[model samples]
Target: MRRPLAEQLPSTLVAALSSAFGVCLLETTGVLAQVLAADSVTGSSATVAALLQVVASVFIVIAVYVGSIVTANTFATIIAGRTRTIALYRLIGSSASDQRRAVAREGLVVGAVGSVIGAVLGTAITIGLVSVSVATGVVPSHPYSYLGPVIALPIVAVVLTTWLASWIGSRRVLQVSPMQATGGAVEKSLDEAAGGRGRSVVAVVFFALGGALLVLGMVIGLVSPLGVLVGVVGGLLSFTGLVLGSPLVMPVALRLTGRMFGRSAPARLAAENAVRYPERSSRTTIGLVIGVTLVTMFAVCVESYQVIITNAQRAQPEVYQGVDRTLTVTVVVFSVLMGFSALIAAVGMVNNLSMSVLQRTRELGLLRALGFTARQVRTMILAESAQLTVAAVLVGLVLGTFYGWAGAQSLLGSITGSPGIVLPAIPLALLAILAVAAAVLTLVASVAPSRRATRIAPVAALAVE
Candidate 1:
């Protein structure tokens, strides 16, 4: 009655990579700040260092937040896959709480292992980079200690967050009745999802409140840049509301996007499969939404900022030239940092897709038994991936563009005297690239699942309980 370590590897890898990325980012920022502050000629070097530290902190938060969500979803899917095993345990007199506690313990162990590995890897990377920089005279040679108590921040944070996320994800265990031991695992139907009207109502309330706050922030922007802070809070609340109501939202979005593909048998089946279980589909795509939204938000904000600066530079080239250069560097740095979150989300998407395929073995097998060819099954899965990615990308782009514009307007409206009147400056090149990336991502993500689906013998897969 033991779970193989391999079953937990995805979540563990996510935790490790997230923690390692955090540590590396922190150390790099710290070292850069130290080098700058060491320059005797730059009087404001200390202040600049403080600002860099703050930016790095924001990046770390984004990474941790994305990583936590991915870890939670991974655990949730794992629990769902183990429904029958858990039910059997329940039949043998095991309590749900005990089983959940055992899962939590497993999570703790996974977190501990990952955090340690990440911390070591991050430290080594930082040391290597610092040594190279010093040797090449890129940075002022100084005795910088990569080993510090500060490193513990990411380690502890990853460990605790992973543990907490696992606990939340395992909530499904409570719903696993011993009676399910006699039946196969199942997901909530559309009707069941719709029956949760209370949750939907709460989601609406939060969303409305957040929308109100966003409007207020825009109005306040007419007077001061501080309004952006309010806008940030509003964005968070509204997004949380969206996430809570995703079961209601993502399916409709998927349906609309699914129509973009030809209505062939495989395509139709793929579309239906995606919406058949709202919870599963919603969770699978939401991570991509978050990733796309964040990346696009930053891109739009930067573009808008550049546009405003360019106009000002035309008026006073000398004064704004340095500012323009600084802005460019800042955007590049932030974009790279934001990429970490996107990567984490990408990992979640791949993990979920893989698990969804694995869990649907019987369903896939049944299709094959019903005269569906392996090629048809593979096509159906690939189509599903394409539709999901398209839906997520579209949603993310819209939300990100709006949020990015709002952020820019809230910050720069006072200077431009336009507040919410300014149009968003979306770079066409970026949009094209995203479109290409989404396509490539879909193909890449679906390959393994499609292959696995095709290779499984119909009789063997159908025999799985």
Candidate 2:
């Protein structure tokens, strides 16, 4: 039964699984690339090769972390909507453990299937890409030797990840009492779940700790690798603190945004809707927050490093000529990697928004029946999307830029003993552009769901579950 259901899972689940598979595939391929480089480089010392492998391994770990979080969140969203079904099983005399087992089994099945398919697809892609690169003289042709282990790693990693994600995701189903599930009260409103005052206190604690670490790191300066480590860790903690505290901040931000629209009905509706379910809205925006924050942080840090390097190059032009080239490569590589992570996160946002629209079908139908125009419905969605995007981008930019600056100060202090701050004008502009583009894209993603809502006859939509 679980196997059949797993086979018939929704497209969204399939998509999320595919993304997880892709991330694993990329990580495996990275390892392979490192191996190939190590083998082919004639003059490189063993230590250099070992360091390269370690770096690749570190990247793979990061990829796994990001991929797992996204997968878990996506799975949780899908499972949350199935409270009634789970309750039905309980009503039919299914034990809680039985239900849990069923869910775990289904997850295992999905993971096995998705991982196998992903491995095949990844192999094909890797072969094609490597073939093209070799043919174009961008890379030297080498006999691929690590193919077996390379393919095996992603398959194992992705399968385990998906299985874990699915199992943990289903735990929420267990939390819903049969009575609450049957009563259609399984899901709690954001305000209820967040417990405003308690959450605020927790948020404040996180902020204080993160801020203290960041300030301490700055004061200590980056005189050693440990200093760099402290700064990086501090920045990460601060970002986490911000995300955790977004719920406390969202209400005021939504109200301000609504006021900016000045009596527009759609804007007011959008803002109210967002505030009405703060938890849901925060979850939707959190993905964007993660993505934008990472991209901005990386960009700012790289640009700041460039500034410091440029200043140093002026004193020793010939010795630092290659430094600029290395910096350029570093920037490009990280930009692409972080950009991919951001794209995955954005997909999560789309899923969240789509689910939100779906859950509101009945409400939307009522609005339509009451003579609200389809255009107004669409406008409302766009307004909601724009508001979330604006809030996410603003928070992400501020946090990321500050972290980048802190990292730069650390690095500069380590290298030159004088920590001078330099703001990269062009990178800041680009960050703004990226933010706008993401907001526009999110608005565009809302179109399909909005159209579907408007197309359903009010009566028919109201009739739907």
Q: TM-scores of all models?
A: 0.85, 0.77
State the lDDT of candidate 2 residue by residue for 25-90, as single tens digits. Answer: 454346344434544332244533443454354445445544455555555555665666787778
Best by TM-score: 1
Residues 1-465 of candidate 1: C-alpha lDDT, one tens digit per residue: 357876888778877876776787677666655665555533254434544554455445544555565556566777777777777898899898888888788888888898888888777877876787667655657888776666677787778877886677667656778887877656787788888999899888877888878777777776776676677677777887888898898899989988977899999999998888888888788878887887788788878877765665676565443453345444544455456546755776787778777778888899999999998888999899888888888888998898888877776666532323567899888789778877777777787877887688999988765
The candidate scoring highest on lDDT is 1
The positional error of residue 82 in candidate 2, measured at the CA in angstroms, is 2.3
lDDT of 1: 0.74
Worst 10 residues of 1 by lDDT: 320-329
| Superposed model 1: Cα runs more than 4 Å off | 21-61, 119-155, 315-321, 412-422
The models' CA-based lDDT, in order, is: 0.74, 0.62
Q: lDDT score of model 2?
A: 0.62
In angstroms, what RMSD does candidate 1 have relative to the true structure? 3.7
Backbone clash total for model 2 is 0
